[model samples]
Target: MKAFVIERYGKQEPLHLAEVPEPKLGEQDVLVRIHAASINPLDLKIRSGALKRILPLRLPLVLGNDLAGVVTQVGTKVQRFKPGDEVYARTDTRRIGTFAEFIAVAESNVALKPPSLSMAEAASIPLVGLTAWQALVEKGNLRKGQKVFIHAGSGGVGTLAIQLAKHLGASVATTTSSANVALVKSLGADIVIDYKKDDFAKTLRDYDLVLHSLGSEELEKSVGILKPGGQLITISGPADPEFAKNNGMPKLVQMIVGLLSRKIRKKAGKQGVGYSFLFMRGSGEQLSTLGELIHSGAIRPTVDRVFPFEETNEALAYVEGGRTRGKAVIQVVALANQA
Candidate 1:
């Protein structure tokens, strides 16, 4: 299989195209012939070694997380999928290597691709879609008619989060710059705050939930805007003890997070609100549910750009710059054209 791999962590210059041996499938895994793969901020962080402590990596690592592909083979225990089945998934972070001609993903982390989308579109949906779904629906338990705020409404996760929140019947508010206000609004954000000009914390108030993607400073201020006992979920850092326990994090990581939470927790406490951090895990069941939503037009994939397989570096550069309005995808194989 052909793959783009990094021979070393830290330097972007080390990323190079190379031929590698295909992954040996485990009893619980399936081999996927990759059609498209999406770039994510998490990939950049991993490539730069920013997550070394939390997610250790070996050298010459292939870097990608979300993919849409066709099943070429399935392990003995994989009864849900078979050869020729089209699937999409947010692959496990520990084994992610989707920037390739193929991937071997655990069956538990694979889902049937939404029938309504192309491979590139399907590839863009998984990671960010799962993140939004887990944050708002699973963890936050956002209710219909309730107000929910999503930060970075024009970004990958924000775009999907806005649509999902609306589909669930929640009145959604989102933050974006002035240029993207119209885009977010069109996607179903009832209110759009221009983060560059206006302070969202001061302008928006009495929200039932705040899906925050920014840093700790913005997260702290978000509590003031929440209605009493409302929840504030951040994807950035400082994990909440209660959510950590519920999510079944390792005891050592949980303990370290607990000590850190005292600082942020005290702040949320002062405002009479709940605070938690979100570290999304892959789930095939959740992916299938999201796929159904996509197929039904309840939620749609919003892609800002698509690059050819050879232009993978350029695609990564675009996503790393943080200027993209929505998801960026690399069409790895153009499976439709091959047929």
Candidate 2:
């Protein structure tokens, strides 16, 4: 089988199309013939070795995170699916390789694709959907009539998070470029701040929660807008000690992470807000719930663009430049002469 792989981790390195051995199916796995795959900033970080100490992925790693595909085979213990089941998943980060013709994902991390979507559209949802679900519903426990600020309203996670926040009955606020103000509003954002024209933290206040996806400067300012006892969940780093401990990192690493987050934690403390870092994980059960929401039209996949499978590198470059309105997808298997 052919897969796009990186021989080494560097921002300057390009993905090479290489012929590799097929992935072996484990007892708890399902083999998928990928129809479409989505590129994520996580893939860029991994490719650049930004997460080397934490991830320690194998050399010659195939690159991709989200996949929508058809089940070609299932392992002995896999009970929920069989051959020909259409599915989508954000593959476990430990064994990510969706930029290929096939991937053997643990059955527990796969879910049936929403029937209302095309393969490329299905591929755009999993990672961003799971991230939104975990942050807004699971961690934030956002309630009706509450106000939640989601930074970067036009990015992959931002697009889904904005819509999901509104569906959960919370008033959503988000920041984006001037050109994207209308786009985020259509995604159900009640308050749209053009980050280029206005400082969101300076204008928005008394929020129940803030979903921070940017870096230290914005993370610092986000706390001021949250009311006392409100939560601030960040998908971007300076990983907190709790996350490090929960994920079983080395004691030294945990301590270093604690040090990394000390400033933000102390600031949130002074403002009487709760702060934690989120590294979204894969869960088939959660994906199922998201699929139902997508099917019902409560939330929709926002695909900014789709590239041919062989143009995976070009797709990555486009996303890396941060030009997308929603999410960018690589259509691995064309449908009905799709461009």
CA-lDDT, candidates in order: 0.89, 0.92
* lDDT, residue 100, candidate 2: 95
lDDT over C-alpha atoms for residue 222 of model 1: 84
**Per-residue alpha-carbon lDDT of candidate 2 for residues 141-229, written as tens digits (9 for 90 to 100):** 98999999999999999999998998899999999999998899999999899898899978998999999988888999999999999
What residue pairs clash in candidate 2, if any at all? none
| Clashes per model (N, Cα, C within 3 A) | 0, 0
lDDT of 1: 0.89
TM-score of every candidate: 0.94, 0.98
Task: Name the regions of candidate 2 deviating beyond 4 angstroms.
Answer: 336-339
Worst 10 residues of 2 by lDDT: 330-339
Identify the candidate with maximal lDDT.
2
